[model samples]
Target: MTDESAAPVSSGRRGRSGGGADARRAARTATTITQAGFIRRAIKPYEPFTDEQLQLIEDNAEIVLQETGIDFYEDEEAVQMWKDAGATVTQGNEPRRFRLRFPKGLVRSLIKTAPREYVQHARNPANNVTIGGNNTVFAPVYGPPFIRNLDEGRRYATIEDFRNFAKLVYMLPSLHHAGGTLCEPVDVPVPKRHLDMIYSHIKYNDKPFMSSVTSGERAADSVAMCELLFGKDFVDQNCVMTSLINANSPMVWDGVMLGALKVLARANQACVISPFIVAGAMSPVSTVGTLTQLLAEASVGIAFTQLCRPGAPVVFGTFAASMSMQSGAPTFGTPEPAFVTFGAAQLARRMGVPFRSGGGLCGSKIPDAQAAYESANTLWPTLLSGVNFCLHAAGWLEGGLASGYEKLIMDADQLTMFQKFAEGVDFSENGQAMDAIREVGPGSHYLGSAHTQANFQTAFWRSSLADNNSFEQWQDEGSKDIVVRANAKWKQMLRDYEAPALDPGIDQSLQDFIAQRKAVLPDSMS
Candidate 1:
């Protein structure tokens, strides 16, 4: 009745036995000895999913597709193709409808073909970034100021703002990924926006960068431009581009977004399928109901990508935040934020796909006590639950509507601290510290011992923010609020930051291209 019976099983047996000892010895001989082995051994086991539950999710998605019908083919030609494909259609006089029909077999195929894990490449080969393993964290530039003109939105963004923010990103040690076009490039017109923003990205940072996913034509153009700059095989060899595909829940994939996916897949680029399901807005109020809605949306995206290109790199981008009844907008930091982060992490593990969740989004007005508490608390469950990659790691404010430089610095510090915690424990023979303990004797101090000095750095977690200064020194220097210190640090980075050198001709060419594109924009847009 179901393909669950055909799921592959691992060949090895678990548990300790005489055979286990021999097998371990053989593994060691094959150069497979573990380093800091405790972390490797300390993983929480995955929970089993019942066949009935899985089927329910599939059924839910089918119902949503048939009942709601996703909107695609904003263009006329694509609409005609859908009409030819036998989808129910209304004539030009009436609004068009797009109902997707997905069979159970298609779902299974998508699940089987999609890669569970992969790396995004950086210009420096050593900086290759991996997802779906041991608290591996990556931050992308977020906040495009979707709703401009509000008091909070006035600071939405400008080209100058984006350039300065890119400079801040270049200096952040903890932000591992550069999200291309971090800000909306209002300077350029809609048609040429991707090219100009991408130029800024390549010129600003050498980190692994995400591709802007605005529309299909732009998506294709962006990929082509990247190939022009970096050469062909850039996508496959380097895994250089990762694009976002947002699905409207309970069921919807617009044509432009779906077309963007096809473009990225054709280029062999990775994707982060983000389903932004707002509870009580796009989904039900109950958490379980919301999760079900998200799962259905995710299933559709997975199926589409696999159909387009099998074995495509895909990360399950679950950015679930509940709607605030008081404000009538999506709330970012709350108990629900923790639930969203934890549940998404677990789901990613179950599906064997990398999970993407937001970080440092406190929704606070200014960098103050509220911001610190909200940020620090939201990330713990995400880290402990083993999320593969974290997006929006820094520079978010007012529920992800704005980016703050001070907030970015604070978040960078928090990210570094989390990485240290995720390092877990050491399990090497010497790391056990039994021999050293015996040598030092039970009652005597280990502080002055050779072993203590040797292992001190490894033994304890260190904080960049927590003050360890003596009272006299602190008094002399004048204790400052974290926000004050963070602002100062932000200024220092801006002053000292150096742009990574690019190929001499490439920079000039990119700038010339940007200038040429900018010249064509209307005076109002410019």
Candidate 2:
């Protein structure tokens, strides 16, 4: 478990003291923007819904919003905000249940204020990406309470495991954002875990990362740390940090999540106004009905963000999936979620904000046949579904209960195929290959031809983990399976990991800010 080669850069002390030859070299050693597996496909992914269906979904969603109204629970500030934004607000007799119906054209007008596409700036400028339109950006797994692997089985995740995952995210080129909660590092105290998690992300990866949503204070700490990493003024101007703010499904927004939502939105950071719903449980089991609720809920959350501050960035996030009625357990990678993915994304486009969904999601206990089959099903459509920001791009298993190290590598390998798929086809002179075709003339091998020699290196999508050897040759290589190979690959990645560099002063200040905030907050768990 000890990795001396790429020991995590100390959050307490990283980077050189000042500008010099040494500092410049250190900066170069840091992971620069090496492609984040996104392809701006000339040919867009195949969308499922037709004009009539799209109209039905949108019309019904607007009906839900304007008539029944969405709930804004337990927060007077939010209630007043909604009321001020032209919603008819009223409190239910029950505690924490507030309902407000929007005017017919309100949500649409609110959505129009948001940009159709906007750039999410990274600490390393070259890593910046446009989050809407044809672009699809991949991000690592978010919340998981445990870590799982063939060797480790299942256990509460530790700081060590979290750091290793961050290193893996740093090394992996497919993942665009080094997500906020790779897992809940239970080893770190709950009250202070955000400090360590945020520090690990800030120090280990130069890619654009997420902010803390555990509490308003933690969320504030994330902004402060961001301000330290990128300057306070620069961050205020650019959309740097994106946070997940989930609406408690069956129509409610919790106080704590709203706290983070407000802080991130007001500062001009982005929020994925997601509703973490199970279709059969928290929502109506029928696909059309569920889509209606999904859109309505997102409309309310998006309206809330604009209420927080007009022109703030938001993603119309969809996490609705079905449940196995037999066991009452959550299900993923099924036809229902795939249905939800395409439908929800279509709805997101209609609403005109960017969307986020389709992670490497599944409900399987281990990285077995079930896990591979389920995850692959979801991933293929994710590229085609017009998902703008793909969260949980890797390392997810057991229905988001655990972050499997081996699964992370395997899922990333899947992303390579989709990134290629997203690129569609090329028909330029070389791609058309008229001359090469004429030379070959429909017969003999192209292996030795001038075309093959010229394009061989770039012709194929190569996988580092998938085995292509014959059975006899495979047995000679220890008869390894995917999980076995993945184990070795992740360990080697950690061994090769170098903590991406930062300016020394920025590094020190980030650490200092974390320390100062930790000092003030009581060491208490929520």
TM per candidate comes to 0.81, 0.95
lDDT of each structure? 0.62, 0.82
Per-residue lDDT over 17-98 for candidate 1, one digit per residue giving the tens place of the 0 to 100 score: 2344433443343311111211111455233334565556556655654555445534444445444534444443225434
| Top-TM-score structure, candidate number | 2
How does candidate 1 score on lDDT? 0.62
The list of candidate 1 runs beyond 4 A from truth reads: 1-59, 62-94, 133-135, 144-156, 185-193, 236-238, 470-472, 515-526
Pairs in clash, predicted candidate 1? 72-255
Task: Estimate the TM-score for candidate 2.
Answer: 0.95
Residue 217 displacement in candidate 1 (angstroms): 2.9
On lDDT, the leading prediction is: 2
Model 2 per-residue lDDT tens digits across residues 1-526: 4433442332222222454454566756654436654557566756788979989988998899888888777677888887877889877867877888988988888777777778887766667778999888888888999999888699999988888898888788888778879999887778889998888887777677899997877888888887776667877888988789898998777788888898998888999989888988999998888888888888888877887888899999977568999989998888988888898898888788898888888888888899888888888778888888989879989889899999999988888877877777878899998888888887677888898899999898888788998999999999999999999999888766677556666766767778887788776655
